[model samples]
Target: MNQFIWSFLCGLGEAKYLNRTFVMDLNMCLSGAHTEDGKDVNGKDFRFYFDFEHLKESVPLVEEGDFLKDWHRWDKKKGPGRMTVRKVPTYKVTPMQLKRDKSNIIWRQFDGKEPENYWYRVCEGRAAKVIQRPWYAIWKSKRLMNIVTEIAGRMDWDYDGLHVIRGWKAQNKKMYPNLDADTSPDAIVSKVTKLIKEWRNLYIATNEPFYYYFDKLRSHYHVHLLDDYKELWSNTSEWYNETTAITGGKPVPFDAYMKVIVDTEVFYRSKAKVETFNNLTRDCKDGINTCNL
Candidate 1:
């Protein structure tokens, strides 16, 4: 099950949530929180863990403990592979808002013209971010090392993700670059069009890890969510059955994104809740696992 920690305060320099505490089974979760052990106000029964250290950063430490004086030794990829609040970029996002916005947005597209303000009301007064999970991109390339070169050659923009799989400061620019001179720009563009035609299923909710994911799944891409979701939802006066610019009168979604799935693999960490396979169907949102989305 998913675990979550709430905000509570101890004697000094400590913040804990007495409301609820939880235990986490982090196969790849970044953070988790839940209601405290008991229902009523408790001293320190609530629990929390830093999965960013273990999954993303490879740090390993005790998962359950009191938060007053002890800290876990979870890994941090950016720093000493250690777990710390100062590690992964974090924002104070309300889980209710995230859940409501994500869920209700789909209904607007599913039905027709829900109030535009409805979407904002869910996301407003909430903390959110557009984090670039670069590790996911790198992990993707390593997963598809075999097909990366071929995928590069077919870029409509001729941009190869293989080059910067390690980052912009790759060891050998001569060996790998996102764009290639030999491939005609026209040909690159054509290839992109052709590829998108066949791979539209894989991109709807995806962003940073497109290259490797597209290569493996050969799915079409979708636009990135952060680019304009907030603005579009904020300014809109009416909701529509679909959120795409092609159908909704917005600017064209980005080519690199526009078709990828976003957070296609997140889950609510519930054992009792039955997971639905159809939620993230490619036909629905290009295979975005929306139960987790």
Candidate 2:
């Protein structure tokens, strides 16, 4: 059964905000590489997330209606959006779980069992709006994109790239024991040697700050990191300073986020890719190496 599903908007949190890029990338891969869905997932998702149908005060981009305000005022905020007959009763699925999955039904059927045929009631309305549109799209910062593009283009898209995601996970030895052990600078350097030949261009994307960690790769391959383009992304850059001001000192680490986004995009467009383990598949992760594009 082919059921058309529409995703519901949940509040943006730390992990979800980052994870959505992967989802959008997956959708892009499903469609093809070097192409985008051309939709802004962040804007559309959050617009619904922040919709205040109950309040008299206007929320940006949401429709204004007297009845919506009156109904909510009388009912004392029964729900966030209009209710539909489609009540998919799920148990033990917390808001956090929903946030992680982004309302995709496929993630629930990972045990080799056939997934049930169900559709979101919301899809009926939104389906028309998204006609001829791709499944997912990402919202990327333009300034960051421009800078990263210029830097990535220097390699002429002819390089093998590595995505080394070592930061909190690597530091926390107890919680993610296997991940921590395998992602150490020593382990990464040892493993990546077999993946790349000497004299190849190697682009690395990592949260680790130790410039010396990549010395081995640098010796073998023409190494590139964010530090290579310090003039554009470094804290001293005027663009970075101005962005911080416009963000009003946002509590979140915006600069770190820019690196992650830029790195993900650049690596996605690379000639070949590699990443940390995918225990479930016993491989180097699906989206990283096998983009199927």
Candidate 3:
């Protein structure tokens, strides 16, 4: 049997697809009689989890959700820990390989005309069932959920979601000229004010300054930001903080990324989810959001 290392290199936000590819790879390995360079490939040891070392160094933590409940949490010098090898034949798999036609290539690599000397398989796919329930489903982190819930508790009232609507879409003015006009604070307030009745709370998620819309929207709805709960998360997020420190402050980027994930998750769970654009067109003139160029 040929020894191989499977390297899954992708951001946390793309875990859903990554997971699908992972399953496909596992099946391919099984089919090809290639066993992971460790204990039994069918045991819990074969499961994937957040690479804490990578996370501390700048990699974002995996998206929080119930789908990740079984993944082994990485603890420093504890738990199963991350995969460590001085050197090995590595097969690098990426998110692009998860697509339809590209996925076929992955199947071929495992069962086709690849030279036998190749020790690494850097692609994805080859599953009996490509897309399955648990593979595509997302789950939130319990710790993050608790933190966000506690923040909500401070408000003493239920709230609706208000995603401020900025990112690749908002950045491309030439491509999405109307995106700025549509997602402006004034426009958002105008749209949301009419829809929401009884004037309750609005949980805000944005890439811009909170105060920009704070005073204007407060007249009708109590405003909230992911930042408001930072202290709560910081105090209790010992493991995250420790990991952050270990990497010499590089984890700072992930701190913001975590907030975004939390914000998106909270928005999804909200009674009403609101965005700037009635339909944020994935179709962009530059093919930024839609096409993979």
Candidate 4:
């Protein structure tokens, strides 16, 4: 079940033309980025939306033809008005959902009954490849995740200014639906503990430079897979800054994440990576305060 299931290309809209490559690996850092091809913004209506896959030709229009107009802007010939230029999301347009504007794209988002299982699919695969495992496979494992559930109740992280934790239902959707979190405490203690230990060993042997963690915009907790991006463009301090802003600079935000309620974590970078791990069951241990290595 730990195998690459599905993936999408990483490049789009950045170029005169988008260059995309499918994620063959499951363990790699990935984020869902939306394009303004024709998608609606909050309180703002739009003509349509299209997935970048459908983007081929560029259309023409007035001063602000598209939201890109602002970033790729031109001065209006004559107009006394301040307008908002939010790009439309044409990338997600379905054949049936085109032309007509959607009711809303921004909603109180959650993993719901299903966590798109896309959760970390791209990340794991990339990580597998990084470790020189050419035939790596990654998928939502209701089985292993069940292991997490029974033992910890949930695994959470701080993402894009949001506090995120997986509950039974949300984690279920993210896991293999047919399976359930290992309900028995003993099972979690035995099986789940073992896997983590083994994975840790394998990871240590690789001696990777840095492990990057990006909260999926939509799905998956991608561990940056490419050799080029072992660490994030920003450092641990930058991440702390972002988390602080998300929580309005609350003093105990990091503590909250590491404590029982929040359960947030980041992978270790080279020097930051350590063989020592503090068991949550333990009163305390070293490196618990460290962010992504």
Candidate 5:
């Protein structure tokens, strides 16, 4: 998902630099790492996780399917030989050099090895200084935002968010020796009590798998987890129905990546936000002893 965002930003930057309408592929493959079943899932619609309408407002864009259809129509009318096309096989062919090329389409092919084939590479080096990534142009799907709004609204928009980065980090003692102990339920209840008032709505944004792991904090605060609002993306929900329609009647699972997006957005809407690295433990985010870096 991180790679997808960066690559999209790079593409958007390229389009802006060339003063051209950006052709975007709405279909995306969700990585295995972010899937619930630990397998890569294909045919995910971009609208499932982002606001395509909002993106269109921010940039001159056309869906890839529409773009291809137009290209084929032109090919039939003028013949394929009449249309000018530039095939870019390497990032070494900088965008700066192709700034004045008279090509109907500048096709970039990432057929090289790992890192080298990365889409963001086109924006590195001198190109980085010229092309700026339009981060504001991309917004999370309003559908997902609806869920975030519903969760916040349920708490009357008055809540304190706690982001506890546990999971592998806590188990990896060599890198985060104190993470497991510091994020323990007992430790969380002890430390959080002093920072937030008792009996307040507390939303815990965590990767902890166990639903009952944060039960210890319930005594003092109304603890809420992402799982508590599963119905928002369930079969009966608007999100599920809309996403299904976009995907031709296929249901979109609320995968782990979607959970993270919702979790982060809800955390942002909170009145007070607490993080694990600095607030709950002394371990560095990257690892131990790297805090000063």
Candidate 6:
């Protein structure tokens, strides 16, 4: 998801540089790490996870499907050789060079391997100085933000946040030897007591699968997790209804990625945010013994 966001930003920067309408692919693929079954899933609507309406307002853009439809329509009408297109097969051909081409279409093909195929590669080296990725252009889906608002509203918009990064990191004794022990319920309660007042609403943003993992903290604070507000994304909810309508009536699963997105956003709204690496544990985020770097 981070890679896709950066790549899209690079593309948007290129379009801005050339003063051309940015053609966006509405259909996106979810990485295996973000999926429920740990497998990549394609055909996910861009609007399902992002604010496309907001993006339209931010940049000169058109949906890929709509753009291709118009392209084919024009081709059929004019027969042949009427439209001008410059097919750029490599990132080595910089955007600066194509600034005044006046081509109808500047199609960039990223068909190479590894680092070569990355879309953001166009913004590297000297081009990086000129093409500024408009990070402000991309916004989270309003539907997801609605869920974040609902979760915050449940706590009356007054709460402290705890981000406990456990899961595999805790299990890996080599790198994060103390992560599991540090993030244990008893450890959490002991450490959080000093930072957050007792009985205060504590919204724990964690990857811990066990629901009862944070039960110890409940004794001192009103513990809240992403699962606590499952109804917001459940079948009977507004999110379900709206997303289904977009996907030809197919139900969209509130997968792991969506959970993380909501959890992080909700955490951001907290009056006091306590992070795992920053507060709960001394372990480095990337791994052990690399904190100075």
- Give all TM-scores, in the order shown: 0.20, 0.48, 0.50, 0.23, 0.95, 0.95
Residue-by-residue lDDT tens digits, candidate 6, 121-183: 999999999998988888999999999999999899999999999977999999998899999
How does each model score on lDDT?
Answer: 0.24, 0.48, 0.47, 0.24, 0.90, 0.91
lDDT for model 1 comes to 0.24
Q: What is candidate 5's CA lDDT for residue 25? A: 86
Q: Kindly list the per-residue Cα lDDT of model 4 for residues 144-216, writing each as its tens digit.
A: 2232232232113211111212133223433323112332224223433443432221111112122332112
Record all residue pairs in model 2 with backbone atoms less than 3 Å apart, i.e. clashing: none
Off by over 4 Å in 5: 77-81
Higher-TM-score candidate of 3 and 6: 6
Model 3: per-residue Cα lDDT at residue 166: 62
- List model 1 lDDT by residue over 1-293, tens digit each: 21112111110001111122222222222211212222332222111111233232322122333332243323223555444332111222333323323221111111224342222222224221321112221122121221222222223322211111122212223443322221222433344444334323221232233233223333333322222233322334121212232234553222221112112221111111111122211121212233245
Segments of candidate 1 deviating more than 4 angstroms: 1-172, 177-188, 198-226, 231-293
In angstroms, how far off is 142's CA in candidate 2? 1.8
Which candidate achieves the best lDDT against the true structure? 6
Q: After superposing candidate 3, which stretches have Cα over 4 Å from the reference? A: 1-138, 235-254, 279-293
Q: How does residue 265 of candidate 6 score in lDDT?
A: 95
Per-residue alpha-carbon lDDT of candidate 5 for residues 57-175, written as tens digits (9 for 90 to 100):
99889999998998987777665566688999998888899899889888888999988888899999999999889899889999999999999999999999999999879999999
